[model samples]
Target chain A: MDQIMSNLGLLFEFPIVNLKIILDGVMIGSLFALAAYGLALVWGVMNVKNLAQGDFVIAGGYVSWFLVKTEWLQSLLGVSDNFVILLGVLVAFVVMGAIGWVCYKLIITKVIERDLFTSLLATFGLAIMMAQIMNLLFGSDTQSLKLEYDTLYFADGLIDLPIAKLIGVCMAAGLALAVVLFMKTSRMGQAIRATAQDSRAARVLGIDTEKVYAFTFSLNAAICGAAGAIIVMVWVIQPFYGITYSVRAFVIVTAAGLGNLPGVIAAGLGIGAAEQYGSHIFGIGYQQAIAVLLLLIILIYKLLRQRRLRQVLQ
Target chain B: MKLKFATLALAGVAVAALSSTASAADCDEIHLGSAISLTGKYATNGVHAKNGYEFAIKKIAENGGVKIGDKCYNFRVSYYDDESKGDRGATLAERLINQDGVQYMLGPYSSGLTKAIAPVTEKYQIPMVEAEGASRSLFNKGYKYLFAVLSTSEQYLASAITLAAEMATANGKDPSSVKVAVAVENDPFSLDIRAGVLEDAGKQGMKIVIDEKLPRDLSDMTAILTKVKLLKPDVLIVSGHSKGAATAVRQIGEQKISVPMVAITHCEAADVTGNFGEFAENILCSTQWAETLTYEDPIFGSAANYEKEFKAAYSEYASKKVPYQTAQASAAVYVFKDAFERAGSLDKEKVRDAIAATNLSTFYGDIKFSDSGNNIAKPMVLRQIQGGEYNVVAPSKFASHKLVWPRK
Candidate 1:
């Protein structure tokens, strides 16, 4: 209790510390928002809650890390290290998109028509398989790329921002913007949104609902892969680290509701900041616990809100 | 016809018994069992430890396997992947004893896994010589059947605290005025490390500014680092196995945390020097054994030779410095071999007694288990990553390089 109080006191004594925490939170939160946005799209369109969402992210990270480590690729490209790393994002996106399509055909397609529990269980199994396979391939070590970029420090170095993380956040924002625009303007995006609204109605109106489902699922995975590629440059990734991203995605999507892009982004940033604050006050041991608690709290709040709405109708 | 068939069956039994006796006279096999982490967070070090055991076993065989009463017995280990979970380790320990009929056992990777397996080994009266588990709590449990070849966890970073105090006094500051920060993972090993640091820091009357536990799936520790920046403590202590060490080094570099001293565990195991390069310089890493030590034995020769041979045998370790986890694991196997020979029997009771009375020297270190089952003859060494090389810098006696204080 005293440590918490003292930590809290430090924030008030140096208000700039708050900015540091929020900045760190927002930078990390943007990546979480990307993963959550993928989850929201999958859930909103296909109604298959992807329990393997985080594994997709980790697999993407490994893909990027492997590419960066390939000396032949580096020599063949004859480009700067930063450009090669950024190129990994594009590569991971397309690769994971193909993987996602394969998964949909092999596993997701089987579970799509089944009950919700079936999809959840199947994806959960997929998540475990993916984590284990990656562990076997990569030797179960935490891997990351060390970017040579400098950090921009401000406020007497109290608030420092790494150029690598800055680039990651910008890329994340750009990806989100591109995704939003595609969903708003593209013909396939309209068909996807139409299928998501009512699959039977779309099929009756001559839309290929099956194609829309595959494309939506693939797009979600591609988005997650790009986010993961960015994450490897900024942070570390391990075979077992996928579950953390999975839980965060669940939290963000649950809090924001499906089909709400702005809500998903806000909730992701909010949860990220809230976690930092909780860890700052309570200590870092409570970081995972804080994430889980926020999830519970959000669920309860939504339940209460729904009850009140039902009572009003009565 | 029935009488002829009975005679044939009797002849078959006699022939089988005679061949078995002949094979036993040639070379008998002593089966040992181990349930180590093979596919989880601890898999890296777990695989290293497994290779250590296998190497030691092969070396012993080449040195004319264990001879007890004019019979040569080769060691064959039955391994099961524990997946790095404590419950899984305990269940596998039971399976090894009850199902596989294994009489002797080898320890798992982490202290948590060791703690779980200790109870099962005790229940089954199995003689287990463990190498990887270092948590002080494991020793205090009074496990008669358990024997550890390495020093306890409390000793891992205790020397770091003493060094910090020594540096403070050299800087013309009162030892009590020194501020310390501790961040450890919330596991049996790291918690015990934290306990040791807190006790030592308390004895020195130093102020503990930041004490925190790292989360299990540790990817980032910037929250703790941000606090360290705010507090500006004299010494920062962290212990979270390999992942924690890697995360700390990466983030400390990015955050530009400039404490006077920063000490952590598992630098070599995590290969932080290789991964982070300049970022890993000047950091104190606690280790069980160093290859530069003068420890030698007939089987593995000197500690340095063991490194060379092990690397030659396991091509994966050719690029990185062999982690002490592997070295200690080989030492544990050596202890078992010595105990079995000294006992002059395959009886579990005799072997257990011999293990409890172990007092020998090996390539890893001198081994003499106290009544509490932890090796008391060996001392933990603290090494600093100087210019990407781990050079011993603490305890003065093992100092290969001077301590670089006030990490740049």
Candidate 2:
């Protein structure tokens, strides 16, 4: 009882500590939402759950790193470091998008014709393959890009934020906004949305469902690739780090449902905040556990909601 | 059948060439086997160990190998990839002994794998001296055939705590008033390090403000740093593997959580000094062996010589800094060679006895195992990553650089 009292006292006494954690969460949460948006896109349109989504993110990061390391951009185009970083992101998008297109043509199309379990297994195999390939190419070392941005401290140094993270968040937001606009205005965007609603109906309406599926998967890969590039700038990346990002994306998508952009962002921020608070209160050992626990709770809540809706209809 | 024939022909040609160079048939080869983590999570360190062992074997062979009872025998290593799994290590060690007919063994990468392989080596009555796997619990297992050359994991962060206490006294503050915040990975190695730090801190009468075990994935240290900021501990000690050390340094910079002193374990494995540079400066870390150490040997001449040779051999082996694991791994092989020479015969019991009664100094350190097969004679040195180089700053006897206190 005394322990509990002291714990509560500690909680109430240091509200600023909690606020600092929340701010950290908000920054990290934006990255999670960006990756989750990609996973949601593929799941909604292609009707195939990409188990290799995290590998795509890691691949994108390596692509960005490769471009930044190579001096071809500086010699050929005479660009600055920031311009090189921008070019790295663009190259990641193109390269991963091409790989995604090739993957769809080679493996994804065959798996899409099979059952969900088969598709899941296939993609899981692809995830393992991609991880090993990345390890072979890049070696198993944790890598990050060094950004020259200085940190920004506010409120008398209470809240500390790195400007590199701010740039990553801004790039993520800009890419997300550009994607949304493209979806709203582009001709291929209509085909993807129509195919997502009802593939057979879209086929009957001459929407070319096959092309939509391929484009959607490529687009998903490109988004994850861009997320990876930003993450390499902000956080560190290793060959085996893809699975954690995939889990977070899965959690956020499940919590927010499909196509709800605001809810995706909200769930991402909530998970981030909960993870920080959980690690703080329960100790840092429970940080990853909080994500798995949140996943379980969200799943149960969803099951309960479905049952309640059925009861109400009856 | 065709592939086997070709392989046999190639082997026969190689053997003929070896025989042409050798004068006697009795001096064929001396074989030692090991299960190393060549793949999986510990692959990076495992590759380093592999390279170290290979380099040591090459050096030994170049020096005309070991002389045993009027015959010279070339050293050979039969390594199996354990894939960084404990059960796999255990099973493979058994295979290396039973099926492969190997009499000697080298230890695997981590403490957990060492624990897994110990019983098998013990049951088979094979003497094994490993360079990695430094958990204190392994020494307490009462296994006679198992010997570890590396300093036990418990001593990893103990020196950091001692340094903090020393600095406190030097600064005209009571050592008892110095506060410590510890974040350790919840593994056997890191837990032992935590225990050592806590016990040492208790002896100094320093207060522990925050203590936390990191999760498996090792992400999100913001909360821990936030607490550190509010409480403002005198020293912040982080004990974990590469990922944990990286996370701590990365988040420390991200949060800008300042402390008077910071000491971390496994800095070389993480390449923290090289990767973080200025951010890692003045951060004291415990190392098993440093190139700057004055330890000397007959074959390698000195610690610096061994490092120079290793770099010259493997040019792409990044990090001009020699990790303690590589040096320790080479030392393990040297122990085998030393024991074989002392035993002077192809006898398992004799070699085992020689290893048990072993006391010698090598390029790595003064290696003399206690009754429990732990190297208690060699003390672990602490280094501060200064200007992207690991400068030895502790044990004043081995001090090559001055200690940076308060980390300003």
Candidate 3:
């Protein structure tokens, strides 16, 4: 009885505390939602899927980190890590935009009239090449930028949030709102929507559809860069990090469906929260299993739903 | 046109025929081959491993290498990047052995990659001086030529447990009374380390609150952080993560979990996370190499100066750090270089004997490769990340500070 009682103490003594975890998840997940917006944008505006969006974000993070560490941008403007990150955002968008434009002009345009499979393969090749170039240039060590943010003890009980995440959360919300406004009202945004809805009709209206694709890609790259800059304040950067983050973004993109911002945000938040809960219920040992399980569940559901529809049609 | 083509073809044939005959002269130089990763997912580990061997290669060449009594022969290396894949690693290993005729080898970044290349090493009968791969089974596989210079996961994790207890006690806490959760990255190495922790933690009467395996490349560890905070584990052990452990520490600090955390296998890269600033303090980790010892030792000071000159010359090439890889790599090459000199011959049997007889002080500590080529003397030390620098804290002989465990 004594031994059993002690073993029970191991099981229940440390109940999964919720507040700190949920808040941290939401705060971090918001950035995921923000970065996911970039992926959704390029896929929506340009019919070309960008497999290198996460690498673009990683590039952005590195740019800001380098600028702050090396004082490279000191002469142009006096700025802290925030300013550097903002600059990184600008640089990521511009550089990736140029790279995307060059990529399209060189390879994608050749496959534009071909099947979708050709374009997908081309984009994948681009992702791999970009990853290699990153390895070559950055040399694969995990690097992070520091932020001077205080930890806020809002309540005595449990919710202790890092001020950095609080800032990042607010910035992500602001960025997401900006993306919404741009898509709704901006002229280029309207051109992108027109091309997305009907590419021929947009060109007939003098939308310059190729320019729209390039601009949209640039915009997508810029948003990813912004996310990267924010992440540097909150997370760490490794060379292959883009591959992992890219997959995570793709998950939200698929779950949320095409051009649905709210759905994306919900999916990101839900995943972040669920991973937290998973750690609680299953122990930290199985947190990653949650994502794999979710992927499997969705896969099974889709298969079953399709089978049911096929039977009905039959 | 036919006559002109025949004349040009004759000249090309002469060039090739001459070059082929000249290849025989290459036999005078002994080439050490390695199938090290310099690209792909685990690119960082590969690149660092390459640097370790390079430092040795440079030293060997500078000293006119392999003084087999009367003859001082030039030693060289033919390296190819395996990109951290087993198939690629094995192919490279075979190419290095069969095609290039490399006799001695140092390699193969991880255990999985090492295991992949093990059969190739055996087939070639090349004596492999391996460092990096800590899979016990890699050595246990009854391969006579394969020798390792570091601790396996079981040995390394035992050290972590001992240090954890000592650290808690040093901080004036009841080391025996605690809820310790074993959180590890879900890989062979991580599983080995954390499983060891659970076994030891269970025996020590520390409640095993959580034991979970995570992905090797998880970008977001906020959820894991939140869970650990909720569990309020006195210690959270995230071992064998190539990249995620730093983020775990940052997230834990952001949430102010205030638990004394121990990150296994990745305390080496903590210096790069200046973004976490002072928040990264008191985060402890274990590794095979010691950086400051090189800075502090007089013998290493000369080597350090040599490294400084090299770094100054090669700053444009790569990131600058007294990397953990450099310590192991430089040691690997020096071990071979010293052995060849001591053996008085470049013969395989003699060099093998010399390697087994090696008992010398290295950057980490005193190192002596067992007859099996495993470093029996090198002990894994526990260190803490303070202001982005990993300061040794566990062993009293080398520790810079008494271990401090933070409590909320």
Candidate 4:
């Protein structure tokens, strides 16, 4: 008990270390929120649960990797190396958008009106297929985009910060805001909201609900693709890493509740900060476990709340 | 016409049967099975191991096979893809032993997969010779049927720490004053390496500032690096595999967390230098084998000759150098060949006994397993990346180049 108290005391003694941890967490949290927003968009608008959300993100990262490897943007278009990442982001969005549309037409369309369990299983299978296909095509290697950026240290080098991560977070925030604006003003955006409210009523009112659903799914893929491109520029990516991203998205969406944009952003950052602190306090091996534990706690809380509400109504 | 056709069919059947028996009569062919990680996370090293095993078989066959008593036996390998999963590897290992009637087996790539397959081999009482899976916990399990070719995981980073102590002593600083920080993956292999480093640090009386466990996927290292910058340890050691090495190299550069020396493992196996280029330079890495070593073999002439042959055979799939995993895998084949010839019989128990008493040198290095089934005689080589090439820098006798102190 004394040892535990000392360990806790050590964590509190260093305010600078805690600050750095929170900064790192918030930056990573923004990326999670960006991906989770995409997941929530599809879930709310189309009611199709996508287990392959992370795979789309990874696929987006790979698209950027492929472009960088070929030097296609630099050689063919004469773009500079610094600008290659931006072009890669655009390409990822379009490529994943097309893939998402095709997925909706083939697999998602059949299971759209069926039970949620059927959609879950179908997407789960889709996720496995995407992971394996990626392995076959890309050859199971961990790859990252190389950026020639300098480190920005503050507090006499006590707090080390990477310029690349700052750039990635900025890009993620900009894309997310653009998505929010599109949903607020565009005709397709209103159609999606209407469909989410009532699909039958929206269809009767001359809104092509099917087209809205497909577009919503594609837009979500685009959002995830852009998020993946930024992630690759910031960190490393592998073929089998899709599931972690999916789980983070699922956790964020469930905690924030459907269609609650502010809550989603807050929950995402909260999870990220909590993860950093959790790993630091309780060894790094339990980092992933913390995310799962947070998910369990939230579910239990929701179950208890529902039980209490039922008793009050009776 | 129908009677004539029937007679022709009967004659064809008789000829086929005679050919089959004639082929079976040649008892000079020895079959070995392997459930290798041909795909998934271990694919990169798995491909290397596969090529090395296949090349060794070809080399031995070219020399007219191994002579056993009055007969000669040629080696052939039958491989199944383990998919880099522990459970799948175990299932494939059992199928190789039972369904394929294989008497000997080669273990899979990673320690986790190897751990799963080791029980299956032991249960069936088949002697399994493996090149990968270096976790010390593996040997401590007391499985008689398992023999590993690579040095144990504990020795992987121990030499790197020893070199740092030597450097500190030469600089007129107290060796005990050398502070080290270690971040390792939370796996059996990484934990074994962590235990080794801690033990060596205690021996040298060095202080360990921060000893933390890295997550398996290596998703984040920023928090750890932030702490590392503030503490400023004399040496930092990182070990996991390719991904862990990649994360360390990348985050270290991004954070500019400069230390006096950094030694990492799995750099050459994962092609870390090839991927990161200048960022990987000046960073020391503990290696299983170096091509510059003066080890000689009857099959491939010298260590350099073996690498030349390997590159020539698989020229299209060129990296800067052949991974040490491939060489170790090939060396496992040599152990079996030597054991088969010494045993002078096809009996499993006799061959196992001969393997236990074996001592041979190959292009990889000397092979002499201790009572615990680890290659205790083999020493881990310390390598530094100089201008994107791996240079041997340790074990004084085998040092190919001088150490670049205070790595830039």
Instruction: Identify the candidate with maximal TM-score.
Output: 2
Model 4's CAPRI class is acceptable
On TM-score, the stronger of 2 and 4 is 2
Task: Estimate, for each residue in A203-245, the C-alpha lDDT of model 1 and write its tens digit.
Answer: 9999998889889889988998998899888888888899999
Model 1: pairs clashing at backbone N, Cα or C within 3 Å? B134-B153
What tens-digit string does per-residue lDDT give for candidate 3 at A12-46? 65443455557766876787787788888777766
Best by DockQ: 1
Compared with the true structure, all predictions reach lDDT values of 0.90, 0.85, 0.70, 0.86
Q: Which one wins by DockQ: 3 or 4? A: 4
Q: Which is the better candidate, 3 or 4, if ranked by lDDT?
A: 4
Two-chain DockQ for model 3 = 0.29
Q: DockQ values for all predictions?
A: 0.54, 0.39, 0.29, 0.37
TM-score of each: 0.88, 0.89, 0.77, 0.87
Model 1: lDDT equals: 0.90
Better of 1 and 2 by lDDT: 1
Highest-lDDT candidate: 1
Ordered list by TM-score, greatest first: 2, 1, 4, 3
lDDT of 4 by residue, A186-299 (tens): 998889999999999999999998899889888888888888888888888888888988999999999988999998899888888988887777666677788889999999
lDDT of 2 by residue, B332-369 (tens): 99998898899888899999989987898998989888
True contacts kept of each: 0.61, 0.49, 0.54, 0.46
Task: After the best TM-score superposition of candidate 4, give how far the Cα of residue A81 lies from its true spot, in angstroms.
Answer: 2.9
